[model samples]
Target: MSVSSAIPTAILTGFLGAGKTSLLNSLLKDPMLANACVVINEFGEVGIDHLLVEKSDENIIELANGCLCCTIRGDLINTLTDLLARRDAGSIKAFDRVVIETTGLADPAPVLHALVRDEFLLNRLRLEGVITVVDAVNGWATLDAHPEAIKQVAVADRIVLTKLDLLHGVEGEDKMFAIIGRLRKLNPTARLLATHRGEATAERLFNMGLFDAAKKTPQVQAWLNDEALSKVHRHHHDVSRHDAHIRSFSLRDERAISPEGLEVFFAMLAAHHGENLLRMKGVIKLADEPDKPLAVHAVQHVFHPPLRLASWPDGKAETRLVFIVRDIPKQVIEELFSAFTDQLQGDAMTDKTLSLSRT
Candidate 1:
């Protein structure tokens, strides 16, 4: 398959009982994901989501209702390979996209690795994005206790906060804001949207990568959320205790930097602190092309190649890097990146530091 023709795949993940299956059901009801295939991976030998889904077939359930729902029979790679064969043979519907719903306990890295490292799937499929469903009612407690939940929030490309109705006028009202604040701190760059009973439109959740879906222009500002960089709001003491290990912050610099310098900084970051570097993404100001900011992103040690946009998104011409790290301090990243670029002055970084100070 040609590069452009590669199927766009989105991984939908969240902690256990985070309403992933409910969101999948809601999305399947809509025409937004028409001709899309789904791979449901549950924890045990017997999958639950496939049974929960109202489908006809067990292996390759082709529903005119909307998308194709396929339960994982073997490993994910084998399952994807099998789906491709079915599509090629006209046994099932031809799908332009694939959405993989992982079990709540699964870590996304290995799953992404399966896609990235697979030879057959690499040319035939492309990772469209990762969408994480956050259960607002129990999400705070989940994050506090589960490392899996924290990782889910960190690596998410887009976060959907579900169960908002449960928080209305309840004593857990403060907990709702607390969850939002925690999500922002864990992944400030990810676009956070609210949903009720998994009612969020499929279109809004998908198609959020380096570029905006409509114009394919760089979406630096939209995903990066510069406003998040301006302040790190504090959560209640109970909330704080849950996510003491995970830290989120932004490093900013108005000065334009050379690509070579940025590459060096990137190398240093991944080499020195790959594991602690949970997720990092942002657009940077380049001296030669000030208007065309460069987009960079990484999950752990896997770094996507830098993309230079045609123009700034929404005219927010500034260099900002949003980072979600574990056991790594904000000052450590600022000093390391600045040391390589020589673009951040001590006082300038200090000023930005003040903006990110815990409230």
Candidate 2:
């Protein structure tokens, strides 16, 4: 649904030496994340200690191109506070978006939470998305050895697999596939991209968050990744480890859903499995407004108001909702919706499979 535009912001994170810097350098060179202010953990000054704030001028570095990069000389909150003040005052160039690159071992939740903790920031900044980088060669080992890597993958909206060119032997190739399997098990909803030598397009990376996006039909289809989600859905549960317990599934409805029923369904999800819900978005037929389908999305416990499109995209009639969740079972969602409206037809499984309970 289209809402008041907040300046889009993205968090870039990965395990140590996971090509995060290379991605940041590449983004700085591009015009895609346009008119953006970047907050980075690294900027030539070698850090000496943890919890010790480095002292430096909080001056904004104007890139050769038209963008601003703020090196964090102090804590992230202080840096953001100063940057906002500078932008307001005429000390720095105006920017419409922001990108924050976290330290290799940093947990992303706190960084995201920081943006929301302050009411002023909540009004000014929108936590757009999380992009995590993984080195293909070392990725499998990294995931296995470090709990941080799994958490990073689990929270990401986009996961970039780097250093594919370095993978040579058949063994290495197999390992790469194995890594992909692990990623899918951890977070199936995230769009995965493979880049070698850091090559990608603006549309492929930027303007992804629903708030800033124009909400074109094609991008919606790409975000859903219906075919890939279905392919990954068949056998992901077998591999869900203790820490990496996540799954994705889609629902379909032949009968139109009334607005009241829709509201009840969303409320049930929030009250029942809010914490486990990662992302949910879909365009579906509404009984009240059948010709004008509705699009809705929710992240964690926050559900945005539904948007009714002028017309259905691509003349697709089936109502669909794709969910990327952590530990919430498919049957739980299915039964809840069925309780409110007509029997829900889960697109990801057969009738028998949909009846199965969460293990």
Candidate 3:
């Protein structure tokens, strides 16, 4: 299939009891998601019948809104391949997009790897973004106890704050803001929305890749959120103990980076610190292609082959990279890039450092 025809897929992930299923059910109710298909992956052997739908096949369910609901039978790849085959055979409804709801404890990186690195699925499905559901009431405690929860927020493109209604009075208000601050420190670039206020709509959650859904234009700036990250970096005091390990930062270079330099930097990064690098998205100014900047994305060591945009989205010729990492220092990344491009100027190359100062 052609790249344009590849179905956009979004992964919905969060910690155990973070309300991932509830948020997904709410999203599926929207008429805008009528053409969307959902692949639910539960932890155990027996899948939970949590979705509000009628069972049509053994594993496939037919939603009233014309959406298909299927549980992962063996693995994600097999389920997706089967869905595509059935769609091609006119055995099932054709879906414009796919939403994979992973088990609460699941790390979204491996799931992202399948969609990105898989040879066949690469041409068929495009990973649009990751929507992580954060429970406002218990989110603070959960993040403190579970490192998985921190990773979920770190890699998210859109974080939906759920269960805010339970956080009522002045004390609750204080708690709510504290958790929000922690989430921002972990991933400042991700768009944070509250589900209780009706903000987590299909319009805001999906199609969060490189382009705006309605305008069909590149929303590079919105996707990168470099400006917002910079703002959060200014105030790094009172770092939370839970979020001390997870860091979000940005790196920028005014000079055009050589193709070889860019490649070596990524290689060294993936080789040494790939495990800590949770998520990365950037717009690069290649020395050879000055006018057409390359848009790049990576989940850990796996990177989506860079796409050449028609022109710079923000009309800027500089390279900007935003990272949500665990225990990876800003200086280490800066030195790696400097070694390649000879553009390192000590701490000047580091645009924003959200890493914990103490630990």
Candidate 3 residue-wise lDDT, 1-359, digit = tens: 65567898999998878887677777888887988888988424223344556557877888877888888878788889999999989999899899998888888998998888778888888788999999999998998888788888989999999999998899999999989988888888999999889999999999789532223335776888788877884455445566787888899987888897688678767877888889999888989989888889999989986777778777888889998888788987876675556754446433322121112
Which residue pairs collide, candidate 2?
A: none
Tell how far residue 163 is off in model 3, in angstroms: 1.1
Candidate 1 local lDDT, 247-343, one digit each (tens): 7788888777777767756766777677777778778898788998887767777776566777777676778887878878787777666654566
Worst 10 residues of 2 by lDDT: 45-54
What are the Cα lDDT values of the candidates?
0.75, 0.70, 0.81
Winning model by lDDT: 3
lDDT of 2: 0.70
State candidate 1's TM-score. Answer: 0.79
Better of 2 and 3 by TM-score: 3
What TM-score goes with each of the models?
Answer: 0.79, 0.76, 0.90
Q: On a 0 to 1 TM-score scale, where does candidate 2 land against the true structure?
A: 0.76
Tell me how many clashing residue pairs each candidate has: 0, 0, 0
Candidate 1 clash pair list: none
lDDT of 3 at 324: 84
Regions of model 3 farther than 4 Å from truth = 43-52, 211-218, 233-240, 343-359
